[model samples]
Target: MLPLIDGKVVDITGPGRTDRFGVTCTDLGASIIAPNGKLVSVFGDTFSGRRVGQGDWRSPVVLIGMGDANHEIVYEYAGGSDPAYARQLWDYIHDDAASGWRRGGISTVIPSDLLRVGGSLYLHAIVNHGFGDVIWTEIWRSDDSGVSWTHLGEQAKFPADLHDGFAQCWSWDFDPDDGWVYVVATGFQRDKGIILMRVRPDQIGQRSQYSSWGFTDGRWQWGQQATPITPPDEHWGELTLRRTAPGKWVLGGFLASSYALGYRVVSSPVANMYTTPVQTPIVGSSGSQVAQLYGGYLLPGSRFGVTGGVGVVVSQWRTDTGWPYRAMQFKAKLKDTSKTPRTPDPVNL
Candidate 1:
């Protein structure tokens, strides 16, 4: 785990607009280890414009983690402050009109989550028609560890309205016990509950191989009509589910109903979620220092097994100001018990 000091959530893109990472501002720093064994983080809605989300607007930019100071993330080729030299995984939809960020026209493809199977990295990204309205989601492959990519084609494409539009946003982790990829999906609009699905590792490219889990015939079984696994009236956004340790899983994200970011621990992918209460270590405030907090993707160094400090990247955006539209690293102190809150407010970091 990367050592975290103080409760301060430091910015990863240097000092923001003029940072040294060659990235001015970015959100959704979903970290994943690249095929080359280097730490990698994928960002959404990256802008190198003189202002936030303005100039050089690009969707889905990936960075190579150099260590955390270590807050530095460089481009795949090389990194610097110049936006023109910035390299992206693909040139699918890049617009730099400064005011041409129209949803339908620009085709803003936001990365939902990433997974590395064997020697390949698969990226699941959503194509947006407009805010909360997804056109479709596609799976892209990179055998050279993100240096290049190949669209897996219609065989791997998932409809935006799959599961009644609840399957647009995804978070997945491979389960070696059954050699299946366990995935939990919610609406990209942040307006729906969650459901579970599993696909054999080798059949990831075939949409037919993906089976939904549900409470059918009085037993939790796959291949049934997908049912909501979340509590009644609970809606989630931008969640991540990872096996932080052997047999131990951590799941949670932006809890839309409560307007806070929290996490819950479970023993297996099929664990009952209602009983495992949400622990909100970080709460969002309208104008607090950590204002407009949303993303709660677990960082690489998080240790959920023994109970200590867990590192995660949380994003903050000033909807009014546009800057501070970046992801920052934070460390939370937690004990083994899941009863309630802990230590003090600083531990709530």
Candidate 2:
């Protein structure tokens, strides 16, 4: 397996407008692999016929998937009116690549991390009533894929007070070893560090069943008070956590201030989550210069049965480029630190 080094990060979407489909100014592109081996992705705040950072088109969410020819829209949640005014309306979008994206049944909440465990599909999303006003993290379940959904109620919320500053739960993954869904969350202020939480797969809908990771008396423990697993100075935006291979876990996200995509590796889910990570520059002037890049997440499936190296999807905004909110794919190689004495220094690609 090739080690992840400072190399060129390419824009897979290519050049021009037709190459860019769906809504503009869309971000937080979270993805999940379907049973049919298709890479299905869900995006937040999509604007139809608009450029990145442009005025809102009132599209709250949109779904797309990788097809044999190209990426096609799977579904889109466009209300009769602006989503800001019709905050109470909850809808669903279905995945039908054969006929293109079609409207599906309705639900009470929007979706973030779309995960499937056993026969049921789980959706993790921010519960917002006002425009850009986040309420809390809500979980929903669907038995017949994305056709229908049932609200599972609030899975987590920011504390009434800002003592811990833990607010929105962003990304998650299921761990087969313990049958738990581990979640990574951060604050709404965008300055607080990241926090970790987990719930049993069966008890995912119950708020009380969820537990936070805590470090007390020089030991790591769950079910205690929540604390920042990352450094106090670093603020994380959208994040993804998943098992790349047996006993190998990878966490990836964008540094809010730097706008640089970075990742951390560990032997197990609960092991050394707080340690500093090796960063690769994706989109910044001093960094990789990919420009306006955010929401860097590892794709669900592996390529060629090689878990050491995988594909990562990052959102390239219109900050520098004229095009806003384009999804770009990059190749990432995970390094085996067991053979090395210490974690390698950050590399600027």
Whole-model lDDT per candidate: 0.71, 0.56
CA error at residue 335 for candidate 2, angstroms: 1.9
| Residue lDDT tens for model 2, 243-316 | 65666677767777555777776666565544435555333324556766677767755332233345566777
Per-residue lDDT over 1-349 for candidate 1, one digit per residue giving the tens place of the 0 to 100 score: 3444424445765353234445677788777777677766778877775447576776777766454322433334322233334456566554324547642354578888888778988888888755666888888887876656688888998987788888889999887877989889999877788999999888888888999988776667789988888887889999888776666777887888888777887777777777667777743222444778888887655654332366667788888888878877766653433333334323112
**Candidate 1 off by > 4 Å:** 1-6, 14-22, 68-84, 94-106, 283-289, 305-308, 335-349
Top-lDDT candidate index: 1
**Whole-model alpha-carbon lDDT for candidate 1:** 0.71
Per-residue lDDT value at 92 in model 2: 42
Model 2: how far residue 224 lies from native, Å:
0.5
